[model samples]
Target: MPGHAGERLILTGPLRLVPGTTEQILSRLADLGRTVSTEDGVTDGLSVLALSVDDVVLCLPTVIMDGRPRRWPSATVDRRIDLTSYAFAEPDLISAYAPELIEHLNVGHADQMRQLARHARPAETEGDIAGVQVSGLDRYGLDLWRVDSAGAEQVRVAFRQPLVEPRSLGRELRRLLDQSANTSE
Candidate 1:
């Protein structure tokens, strides 16, 4: 595969609770590599990125470290997340959006990841979900965006609640992205 340039998208607002340690997060990210197909998953490895909760920012290609209330940009988002505010929603959006990636999955690449990230953080824009400020999202949450290599975008729910249970939503999104190709053509 040839090297490709990437894009930068971010998720702003409030962060959720991180479940693990930074060391563990780094190690897991390293092991997971860039492609989800190559990753073993958090069950066997580490959520690495999951550790972030209230301060977590799920950008494309990689995860970001939360700044202490003064992260260059604003503290929370007005309505939608933004770059620099959190980081890229689909850190992989760039590579996935490559012209070559056009045939990679049935679903659209960069756009798909953005869609999922938005859906993952669905909560009270009032800045409170499950008693916490819904700041950012991670892989575990952005599932709706996932579509097979060739599938079409078929979003079901427009909004989500609880925010936590929906964390599992990422699985469904991934499945969709992985199967999107099959569904499209």
Candidate 2:
């Protein structure tokens, strides 16, 4: 997952050390427009260097066995690094690496979600399941805000079948509303 700065670049598993000095590796990363930084840490039985650039963080891992750098069998590097805090702040960088994320965060999805919210029906229950408001919607599912006496509860409902078209979403909403109505009765 070596995408742009804003997009997620997920690297999993062990990484084989490149045939070069530490300085050389760092230089290579710099050439790729990354601001390289080193931390004294071990990740997945390997010496890890934290690389940061344009608000993106990546791990440069080296294989170390028996207190020495050893050659790995495979060239692939895999390690779990949590980058939830990192964000793509630059639009140009995001477009270069992960254009799909840009598309997802676009106005079109917001508009669709707005439309879905307008069409959402009230729940028939008198308890916590008060009014059913479609708060957010994506290709996968819809997020619902179940307004109640206590507070607004968030509920996400994934479609049982993949919605191939926009019209299908309306049908699914109707079905969910009907099911809720029946359950309340």
Top candidate when judged by TM-score against the true structure: 2
Off by over 4 Å in 1: 1-110, 113-166
Residues 1-185, model 2: lDDT tens digits: 44332233553344444556656765776788965443854222323354343333343344566896544344435444444644423233323323443245233444433333333434423443345545455556767665556667676677667565556656775675566557546
**Deviation of model 1 at 80, angstroms:** 33
lDDT per residue, candidate 1, 79-169, as tens digits? 3344444445424442333343324322444555543433444341233221211222332332232233333233343223322333334
lDDT of each: 0.37, 0.49
Q: Candidate 2, which segments miss by more than 4 Å at Cα?
A: 1-132
TM-scores of all predicted structures:
0.17, 0.31
lDDT of 2 at 123: 43
Model 1 score (lDDT): 0.37
